[model samples]
Target: MRPLIGLDQVSVAFPGTLALDRVSLQVFPGDVLAVIGANGSGKTTLLTTLTGLRAPTGGTVVDADGPVRLRGPADALTRGVALVPQEPQLATSLPVWENLLIGHGGLRGAAPGRAARARARALVAEALPHVDPGTPAGQLRKADRAIVALLRAQSSRPKVLALDEPTAVLGDRGVEIVAEATSRLRAEGGAVVLVSHRLRDIVRLATRVAVLVDGRLVHDAPIGEVSVEELVETMAAGRPASAQVTARVTGERPSGGSAVPRAREHRLSVEVLAVRGLREHGLSVDELTVRAGEIVGLAGLAGSGRSRLCRLVAGASGGSAPVTFLGGPLPSDTRASRRAGIAYLPEDRANESVFAGLTVARNLEIADVVPAGLGTLFGPRPDRSRTARTISEFGIKTASHQTEITALSGGNQQRAVLARVLAHQPRLLVADEPTQGVDRTGRAAIHTMIRRFAESGGAVLVVSSEFEELQELADSLHVIRDGRVVARRPPDCEYRELVALATGARDEKEAEQ
Candidate 1:
């Protein structure tokens, strides 16, 4: 079959980073090509190149019809190509229906007739029943926003679809929607290019798989020819491997009487934080606790209230939840939370956690120093020596402390954010999606930092969508559904069982039995 789109020896470079190097690939009609790579390995760059968001520095993009030069996203769209970005790109201020109608010319510009607008609304409603078309995009949860983006892209009916981690933030239902869309597109002879870290999704949706490492395509083969273990090994080693795998601890302690002593010891530990009557953003938790030196994980599908719960506990969200820290009543405010020795790492690190224009040292200092008012002569300055120490401790790679945080890669930026949060040495740490977009190395570093923090007598609560992440990093996990904790499992819980619990496929009783 003739390829619908092909990249011939493509190369893309940005300043110090060579994102993609002499990479060549093709997507044919009905082909679902999964692109797998570690963080910073150019999977996103490849998608951008194909979507015309970034033109390749070398090589040509050829369609079955002929060679094509894409000037911009619109040009690519005009040629029946569409991209669903990793991040939701909806207009937050606009109503959901308006956002969905953005590129379709149904509600804006030369406005379409009433019938056309109604048709668009019906399409969105049919495609995504969970999303309210009348709601403001910003008011909706993150997962809902992502769904809006997917529906918008699918509504275009592009001949070629490019999805960048479509299932990363989505729950089982969301994954089903995406899978259905892929099947429909394939049935209609359209092509798909998927970039994802979840090996399960790749195994389910991809017919062909391509591995990328250090900006180079290392392997390409049929999905049937490559196992999940092989993919993990290739990504971890950054090259093909033939060595036999060895089993490691599955993060579960021994059961029966052997585990009783440890469980009792943990229960007797001082409670670093406690919450009661917590309610915010449609999520409610009657009681939650984290003991000193414990790492607790909240696992749920997107929009299941995992992040919202974290924010509420961190005092970033307004709620009536009664919170206590270190046996004392805690006020529901950001400053109070910080003063009470609570550190929060928001999920939206790019915008919420880091100041892109500020120096790394300055960003780190903000954790300790508050900005002065107009009456004050000068604001607090960063302790240079302390900042230097933090840089080393967090393994943040930067030219200097004076370098802007935006200049670093996503993983480095995340590390900087973590370093800033940890500078205060809070008693409790609440991290949301800490390793969402980081590569294997970066994830290991972050995990190590979290583990070390807990080891140092601090309590940690992590909210993540990746089941395997929670399985590995969390000593205990809570599965949330519809804004409530439905099940609690040990770190050794089966991945499929955890998913089932989170999706409400099986209740806590059933899962336990």
Candidate 2:
């Protein structure tokens, strides 16, 4: 059978890096192609080239009909090829049914007439029978949002669906949702190209596996022909030399402050902030705290009030004085949070956390300068010595300190942001979806950073959609449902347990409520 889509000796280069080097790949009808690689191995570049999100620096892309000329996502989508990003920004305020007919994931300008609504309902029934068609995209659980995205794409019945790390932040149930959708697509003669680091996903859904090593197609074989062990070995062979760790963070707590919260009384000797009664914007937190040398995690589905609580704690203006930070009311603004020794990593890293236009060095140093109201271009040259040290300490892989942050992979960008946050030497770290889009290698590296920071007596509170991540990272894991702390378990809590509590899926009776 002819391939539905393919890359013919494609190459993508960014200044100092060859992101894709003469890589050739093909997706046949009914194919579930699994693409795996280590961090910065050009997995993303390959996907972008295939989907026309990025024009190849060299070579061409050919479809069954002929060589595709246009290099744009719209052209690809128009030709029945769509790439669903890792974090698909759906229209959260609109109901899932409407979003399926209008917006990024769906056919823009598709009238929401009776027939359109009928088609959307049929797709939802086929892919996500449990989800309500009318539920706002924001209110559905994380997994549901992901599934709805698939259904939205399926509405167009694309010839090939390219998914970028769809299951990275998901659990067993979430993965299964995508898996079932893939099966349904393949059964209908549609092809899927899955870019992921999870071996289980490759083993579970892929009809064929393709491994990239430093932008080259190093391995490609039928799923039945390879073993998991060999796949792991192949990817690891191409990993760059392990990143070096140069220095440890100073764990010393700054001298105590006398200002206390008048909102509520606190009994526990606080290490991080202690929230007694946090009620704002439909979220309510009765109690949550992290000791100086501990890591606490919050796990919940989408719209469960996880990010809202983190924002309030991170010193965004609003909400009651629900927290006491090192004997003072919680800092009320971003600059104050940094000044008070608190570093908050926002959930929307691409838009909120990192400055894509800035270089890696500038991104690292801006946390310090911005608080002082200095522009990156006009600011006194960043402390070159400290910038170098932070790069080494954070394992940020950039061609040079002067490299724009967007040039690097998602993992490297995330580590750079973490390094910038650490530049403030914060007492508490509030990280949301810290490892959201990174590969297994990057995930391990980030986990090490969080652990070391907590080991240094810096308190931490993490919010993650991935339950397994929270289980692995938190010393004490809290489950939030409909904005209340439903349960708290030790770090060893199982993924299913957290999923049940957060999703209200414990038992038939509980699921009803």
Model 1: pairs clashing at backbone N, Cα or C within 3 Å: none
Candidate 1 lDDT at 440 equals 65
The prediction achieving the highest TM-score against the true structure is: 1
TM-score of each: 0.64, 0.57
lDDT per residue (tens digit) for residues 1-513 in model 2: 888899999899985568889988889988999987654578888888888889998989999986887569878888888887777668999887877787433455545678878888777766667778777889987667777777777777788999887874454565787777788788888899998765665788899999887788899889889977677667656322211110111222212311211111222355677888777656677788887877788977655678878888888754257778886788768787788788899999899988988888888877767566644566656689989988998898889999999999899999999988977678999998998788767877888888878766788999886555565556678877666677777655444455456544442244331
Worst 10 residues of 2 by lDDT: 240-249
Against the true structure, candidate 2 reaches a TM-score of 0.57
Please give the lDDT score at residue 223 for candidate 1: 93
With a 3 Å backbone cut-off (N, CA, C), the pairs that clash in candidate 2 are none
**What digit string (tens of lDDT, one per residue) describes model 1 on residues 114-225?**
8867876786688668777777888987777778898788878898999987876675675687888899999999989998766677888899999888789988889999
Model 1: ten consecutive residues of lowest lDDT: 239-248
Q: Give the root-mean-square deviation of each candidate in angstroms.
A: 7.8, 11.2
**Position 390, candidate 1: lDDT:** 92
Q: lDDT for model 2, on a 0 to 1 scale?
A: 0.75
The per-residue C-alpha lDDT of model 2 at residue 402 equals 96
